[model samples]
Each structure stands twice: as structure tokens, then as C-alpha cells.
Target: MSMRVLKSTGAAFVMQNMRTCVNKPIYKETFDVNSLKKICDMLVVSAQQRKLVRLAICPQVTQHQIWTGALMEILNQLEIEMCVKDCMKGSNMAQQIVVNCLRFLDDVVSYDPDSTSWMRVAPKKDADSSPSAKWSDLLEMFNDLINCLKNDHEFLFYVIKLEIMKEGLSQIKDVLVDKNIGYKEALHQQSLVHKKLTKSLGHSSRCLFTLLLYYLYGSIQDIELDICWYSEDVSGNKLYLCVGKIIASDEDKMLMHIFKQLDRALGVIKFVHEMAEMKEILEIQGHLWCIGSKNRSFAYRGHNFFIHGISLE
Candidate 1:
């Protein structure tokens, strides 16, 4: 099928499916702590849970159909699973982990908050001559890749993905251990970030950080790459971006860029702090881990950003 045709049909099919399953239960009626624990146990020891999540969040599926149900279901299961075995086993913490999982899907989906991004898909009207759009070809290539992965039982990506997940769960433990109010406050403020990404209430920065942590844990095959952070805070009503890495030929350039971004971020933090009255905010400082590399001085110059009241954690 042509790429445009596939796009059109795939979209239509997805819309139809969304309408159909919009009401279908994505999860079991009641949250079973045991079943959730089972999933988590399997997840900790096996990589299949990560694979299911990665496939479920694939752009092709998420863009077409609303998989909130599937997500909720899996999340509910995981929460149940983790609570029994781990000290973090409570309705509150369980829900937090599950909600964090949803944010992963948020990044992969075609999200137009204002519904004005349709032009990204529509072919340009100024086509003078028939230029065969590469989109169709790309889609075909992706489809072929998916088929090959399925046929050959390729599972390397999810292997990395699972490693990241373990990191996320570990963060939960870390959050519990940290006793500073600033750390707790930042964690509380992160709830807003969670809401922005998932549009779900009562969940925030902890989830975004969890996602960041998981991605950071997951490694790129054979490449010493940097981290990418997309985090937010709604209570503080601020957004944070750590898009990819700064490509620099020398430390001086990298330090300069990092300082520049931090200076701008500090400005943003100050503005947010002044604009609100006793508002909650998330303070995040992101620095790429360059361990096991040359000249890994473990310094990125500036490494802090604030939303409400900035504090080093």
C-alpha cells in the first residue's frame, strides 16, 4: 500500500478502534495486589513485561487507538505486584508507578495539545511537480522492520528498555530514602509534571523523573550517547526540557552551552517563582553521565533549574 494510503487507512482504522474500545476495560475491575506483584516479579526477572510495554507504546498503535485501558491495566497490575514484595507497597505508591508508566506512552503518541499540528501530516499544497513523498517509503520500511523483528524474535531494544525500568523502580526507593524537605518538595512538585504529560491528576514530577531515569538506564547499542530529558511540573506550572546532548568539540564549548542554558533556566525559575503565591514547584538539575569515557571529568558546568523555590537536591 502507498504510504499516504496506509496513513489514511491506518488513521481511520485507529479512530474506529478508539471509538470501539474507548469504553472497553483496559484493566480488571479490581486492583489485585497479588497479580500486580506477579507481574512485577516477572518483570524484575524477565524482560517480557518491558517488551509488552514498548510494543504497546509504539507510535503506530498509540497514534491510532487510545490505549489508556491497556496502560491502566498493566499499571494496575504492576502496582499490585510491587507493593507486596517491596516496602513501597501501598495504594498510593502503586498508583504512582503505574501512572509513571503512562508517561512513556505520552512521548511516543501524536500529541497536538491544541489540535493545530495537523499540517505536520498533510501534504504541502505547493507541489508544483509530482514529487513522490518519502513518507510512504519510510512507513513501508518501518513496516518491514516490524515484520522482521517479529519473525526473527528480535528483543534487544526491550532488553535495554527493561534495564531502564528497573532504574525507575529503584528511583522510587531513592525518593523514599532522601530526607530533605527540598527533595520531598521537588518530588511533590513533580506531580504536576506528571499531569501535563499524562493529563492525569494527582501524579507529577516523580513520573517524569522515573521516565528520565529509565531512559537513562537504557543504553544505545555500541554508542556512548548522552541523555535526553523531557520533564515538567504543573503545580509550579513550569516545563523543563533536556533535549538530547550538546555536541561540542571541546569541554570549553560544552561548558559554555551548559552555562547558557542554565542561565536561561534560572531566569525561567525566577519568573515562575515570582508569578505565583506560595506555589509548589519542581526543581530539577540534569547532568549527563559520561562515565567510562575519555576526559570524563563528570562536570557539565551548570546543572540546576527551578520551578517554584529552587533548591539543590
Candidate 2:
């Protein structure tokens, strides 16, 4: 069938079949690898046409059938050199294919069939025939691609760096350490691969570093804004000062407000200090308020006061 027609009909067919099997188990014995491969090939054609096609297949089918056969076919076509060559010339078809392949692989590996009752694990025939073994093989392929990207195709590597980190590093980690598979050795090996990948990428690009920090800390906050506060009692007898730092993930408008508050606070402090020196007073009587308008306020000794603060950017 022509790919144009296939793209339209293939997804409908798969969705229809999937809907019918909603409450039923999809056995590995009855899984159709050839059909899955044909669908994957059509996805490639869709990418070549610069069209977006969403193909929804059973995750069980993807995990079991595609990993063993169809996935290799997709991966083989994801050539880094092709992507780089096309990208340099202002074409994105090759890069699109790579993206589609990554999306397919993501769908295959990201699904957690162990938590569902509709997908049963196929019986293992030997040590090398289990699902964990398949995952190990998949990890090996990812490591090979990553190494190639790091060593030779630096440009293409940065282009798809986030997707690789999300799928290869994040999702694959979940698969390797799945309680059902329990592949500790495989997980350890994957960790080593990640360490090498990160070390190599960390030197040249901040993309991987940002992603790694997000994965490690659950958020990326690289911009540290130091803040200081100065306050005095109503009697102006005692001075209180607090200093700290804020780690911001992005420079949003809220940060601008913080900056303004810091500037205002610094001005107030300077004015108060100069006046205190001019009068030869031991301390200033009025508050050196440097707090943002929206910030928290506290009441002390029947007087409400704002915290004096400034950012050391």
C-alpha cells in the first residue's frame, strides 16, 4: 500500500484492534512483528513527508514485539551522519526521522506493563531469552549511539541531546531496575554508560548538564541570587540582619521585581548609614526597609515591618 494511504488507515486499524483487546491479554505468541515493522516503516515515510502522525499501539505489543524485531529496523535507519549532513544544509527530514525513531523507542520502553494485568510476561527459555536481556540489548544500542554522537557527530548530538537524556538515561533506568526484571548488573552497567556519557557531554554542552541537574535535583536552579536584609527595633536600639541566597531556575518577571526590591533596599541602607554618620548617632532611628512589596510581613512590638533585602547578583 502507498504510504500516504497507509498512514491514514494504519493507525485506525491499530486503534481498532487495540480497542477490542482493551480488557483482554495480548499474548506474545500471537503478537505480529511484521505488521509492527510495517507500521514503523510508514512512520519513517511520514517523517520524510514532513508530516506528523500519531500511531497508538498497545504498549505491550511495543515492548515485546518491537523490541525484538521492529525496533532494530527503525534504529538502523536513524543515521547520525545523515541527520548532520541534512541539518547543515538547512534540511530537517533526516533529523525528523531520528526524532520519530526516538519517539517510537520512547513508547516501547516507557510503558510499565508490570503494573497492568492485560500484559503478562512471556516465559523465559534461558538466561539470554528473558525480557531483561532484551532491555540490556536495548541499552547497549543506546550506549553505542550515544558514544558515536559524542565522538563524531557533536552537532547532531546537541540537537537531540534532550530526547536522548530523557529516553536513554531516564526511561531506560526505570526499565533496567524494574522490580519484575530485577537486573541489577544491567542497571550497574547502564549507570557506568550514563556516567561516561555525562562526563563527555558535560565538557562541551550545558544541555546535558541542565538535564542531569533536573534529573538529580528534580529542578534546575543555576542562577543564584544572594539577598540580604537589615532591620532595627522600634526603639532603633538593636539591628537585625539576615543574609541568604536564592537559586532561580529561570529569569522570569518575578526576578525583576526581586531585583528592583534589592536596588531599593541598597539605596535605603546607604541613605540611612549616611544620615546616621552625619548626625554622629550611634544608630539610625527609621527602618532601612529593602523588602519587596509582595513579600511576607511580620509584626514585632506592635509595629509591622518589612524585611530589608537586596540581591547580590
Instruction: Identify the candidate with maximal TM-score.
Output: 2
Query: On a 0 to 100 scale, what is the lDDT of residue 247 in model 2?
Result: 21
lDDT tens readout by residue for model 2, 2-103:
533433343333334434322221221111111222222312223322211112112212233222233333344445456546544433543554565555
Off by over 4 Å in 1: 1-244, 288-313
The C-alpha lDDT values of all candidates are 0.31, 0.35
lDDT (Cα, tens digit) per residue for candidate 1, span 207-270? 2222322232221112211222334454535434331122322355655654454443333333
Candidate 1 global Cα RMSD: 25.8
lDDT of 1 at 184: 35
Backbone clash count, each prediction separately: 14, 1
What are the TM-scores, per candidate, against the unseen true structure? Answer: 0.18, 0.25
